[model samples]
Target: MADEQIEVLVVGAGQAGIAMSEHLTAAGVEHLVLERDRVAERWRSWRWDSLVANGPAWHDRFPGMEFTVDPDAFASKEQVADYLAAYAQKFDAPIRTGIEVHSVRKNDGRPGFHVETSTGTIDARYLVSATGAFQKPIIPPVVPADAGLHQIHSSGYHNPQQLPDGNVLIVGAGSSGVQIADELRRSGREVYLAVGPHDRPPRSYRGRDFCWWLGVLGKWDMAAPPVGAEHVTIAVSGAHGGHTVDFRALAADGITLLGRAEGVDGDVMRFADDLRTNIAAGDANYLSMLDEADEYIARNGLDLPEEPDARILGADPACMTDPVRELDLSAAGITSIVWATGFANDYDWLQVDAFDENGKPRHQRGVSSEPGVYFLGLPWLSRRGSSFIWGVWHDAKYLADQIAIQRSYQAYDAPALAAH
Candidate 1:
C-alpha cells in the first residue's frame, strides 16, 4: 500500500507549489504539496546574498499580499522568501516539507500516478510538477577542468569574499554575470565580463519602472518570444535602489568587457570578436522597447512626460574600438571563474512521456497531454510572465480549475460504473 494517498499531489514548496496549494484548496480539491526543503527554498538558499528580485515589489508579489517595502522598491532575497512563506502560512497550505520526491510514474492498471519519495510512496489521481524552471545550472565546458582555478556557477556564488583574492573572470553577460562582475570590481578586484546575447532595458522610463510600462502596454501578457527567437535574459539590475544597466558605464567603471567566451587553449581563454555586435543587439532591444512604450502612450494620449535620456544609453564607443580576443588566466592573475550561463530542466525522475525531444515539458498552459499530469512555473508556459510570482499564481488557478473539472468527470463515471 502507498504511504499516503490524495486526490491531487503537487511536487515542490516554492512559490509555484504553494500557489498551487492555495488554488487547490479554494477549489476544494484534496491535495498535498511536497517540498524537499523549506518553503521558497530556492529564494532562501540557492541565490547569492546580494541578489534582489528583478521586478519591483508592487508588481512581483501575488495578488493577496503586499510587501512592506515601498511599491517601487525592489525586494531583497530574504524578504522575497519571507513573503512567500507568509503567503503560504496565511492560507494554511498543506505543505509537507523535507519530503524529497525520487521518481514519478504513471500507475499501470490504474488512472493515477505513483510517486516515490525519500520518506515513502504516494498515490494520487493527479500530479502537478511545480519544481520550477531553474532546476539545474548549465555550466559549459568552455574552460578546461584541469585549469587549476576555482570555478563556481552563478547559483553557487554567494559573495565577493567567497572567492580567492585575485582577478575574476565571469562568463555569460546575463543579469547574474553583469551583477557579479560589478560587485567584484567594486570590491577592488579586476573583473573580466564576457558579453553574450541579452536584452538591455532601462530600469525606469518616463517616470515609471520598466515593469510598469510592460504592464501598461500589455507586454507582460505577451504570449511568446518574437518569431524565430528564443527568450534572452534582460540585463537590468535592482541593486542600490534600482538603476538602468548601461554596459558603457560598467566598462568605464573598470569592468573589462570582452566578447563571448569561445574556448580555452592551454592557459589562454579565447573570446569571439563579436563584442560590438552583441552590444548593438542589446541596444536594439533597448531602443525597441522604448519605441513601443512611446507608441503606446501616443496612441492612448497618456499625459506621461517624455524621457529622451532613455534613448541615449547606447553602445560604448570605447568598447567598439577594440575588444580583447584572448586572455591568459595565469598571466592575468585571475584566481576565480564564475559561470553564469543559466540553467537547464532536470526532470529525469519524471518517468512519463510528457516531454519533447529537447527534454522540455509538453503542455498547453500547464495541462499535459498525459492524463492527470501537469506542469507549472515554466517560462512562457501560458504567457511571458508565467514564471513570475504573479504569473505563477494565475497559472496555478488554471491548473486547479482543470483538476476540479477532471474530478467532476470522474464522479460521473463512477456512478455509471456502479449502476452497470
Candidate 2:
C-alpha cells in the first residue's frame, strides 16, 4: 500500500470521534477522523420520523452546546441529529466524510498501521476505531429466511409511513422495540411487542425524572471508574443499551407484550413461556428501586417539581396474557419487521491485532494494548456513566489528559520552575 505518515487516525465521526478530536487537538496530537458517510449519518438516517430521543435532551447532548429543548423533554431524532451536526462544527473537528474504510492492515515491518479506504490508503502511528458499536443489524438464525415475514432492523426504519398497513410485530424487547411498538399503535396499526430482558427506568417517577437526579447527584458519573473514569467509559451508541427506557409505560399503554420469539413462520411468532416471569421481574426490580428512591427523597427532604404516584407491582401478575399470539403480517399487509434487536459492532478496519476473540478491543479505560493508541467516547468505556453525554464529558477530559501525558507533552509547558 502506498503510504505517507501521520501521528493518528480515527474512524467514525459521531460522538466518540468528536470527543477524540477535541483531545488530540488539545494535546497537539496530529490526527484525522475518517468518516465513511456524512457526520452523524446514522443518527440522521436511521431514526423514525415519529421517534424522539428516549433520554432527556440534556443527557444526550454533546460538549459546548446546551440542550435547547426542555431538560425533561424528549427531542425528536431530527433535533438530535441537528445537534450532532452542530457539535461537529463547534469543535471544527477534522472529519473527512465519504471515505469508506476498506480494511485496516498491520504493517509488515513498520511499527505503524495502514488504513485502506474507498478513496486511498493512509498510514499512521495511532488508530482509534471510534466506529461505535451499533454497526450492523442482527437477525436470529432461528427465524427461517423463507418465512414470508416483513423484517427490518431499527437502522433501516425512518417513519411509520414506510410500514405496510395492519398489525406489526416488533421483535426484541429492548427500548427500541417498546418505543416502536408504541409508535405503531399510535399510528393506528395493531402492534405486538415480543418481550425480553430490557434495562430501563420510567421517564419520570415519584415527581422527578431519573435523569434529573442523575445530573444532579452526578450519579451518571457515579458509575464512572474510580480512575480515568471519564475517558475509560464506553459509549452509549444506543440509548437502550446502557440506560433504562420506560418499559412500564409501554405496558401501561396497552401494548400486548408477548414472550420471547420461539420461531416466526407465515407472520406468526411462537414465544417462550418465560415472558411472564421476565416482565414480572422487570416490574418488581423497577418498583423496588423506585420505593428506595422515594424513601431517599423523603428521608433527605429532596424536592422535585412534579412526581408521579409510585406503586409497586406484586411478584405475580393478576392475570396472565396468553402464551402464544400471532399478528397477521399478510392480513395487516405489514411489510417490515423492525429488529429493535440492537446492533453488532464491527471494526475490521482496525489494522492492529489487539482485538479479543469476540472482536472487541481489549483496553483499560480507553487505554489500548497498542501503545501510542488510545480510545475515547465509548459507553461505560470506563465507569458506569462513561457513555452518557453528562457522564462522558469527564471521561473525555481525563482520556485527553492520559494521551497528553503518554505523549510526553506536559500540560502547558511550565516556565522553568523558579529557582529556590
Using TM-score as the measure, the top candidate is: 1
Candidate 1 has its poorest 10 consecutive residues by lDDT at 411-420
Predicted candidate 1 versus true structure: per-residue lDDT over 217-324, tens digit per residue: 787899998874585677989998998888888888988889889999989999999888888899898888899889888998989999987787645646557888
Q: Write the per-residue lDDT of candidate 2 for residues 234-307, one digit (tens) a residue.
A: 11112332234444455555566677777756555567777677676666656665766776777789785444
Model 1: lDDT to the true structure: 0.89
TM-scores of the models, in the order given: 0.97, 0.83
Global CA lDDT of candidate 2, please?
Answer: 0.66
How much is 256 displaced in model 1, in angstroms?
Answer: 0.9
Error of 1 at 124 (Å): 0.7
All candidates' lDDT scores? 0.89, 0.66
Lowest lDDT 10-mer window, candidate 2?
A: 229-238
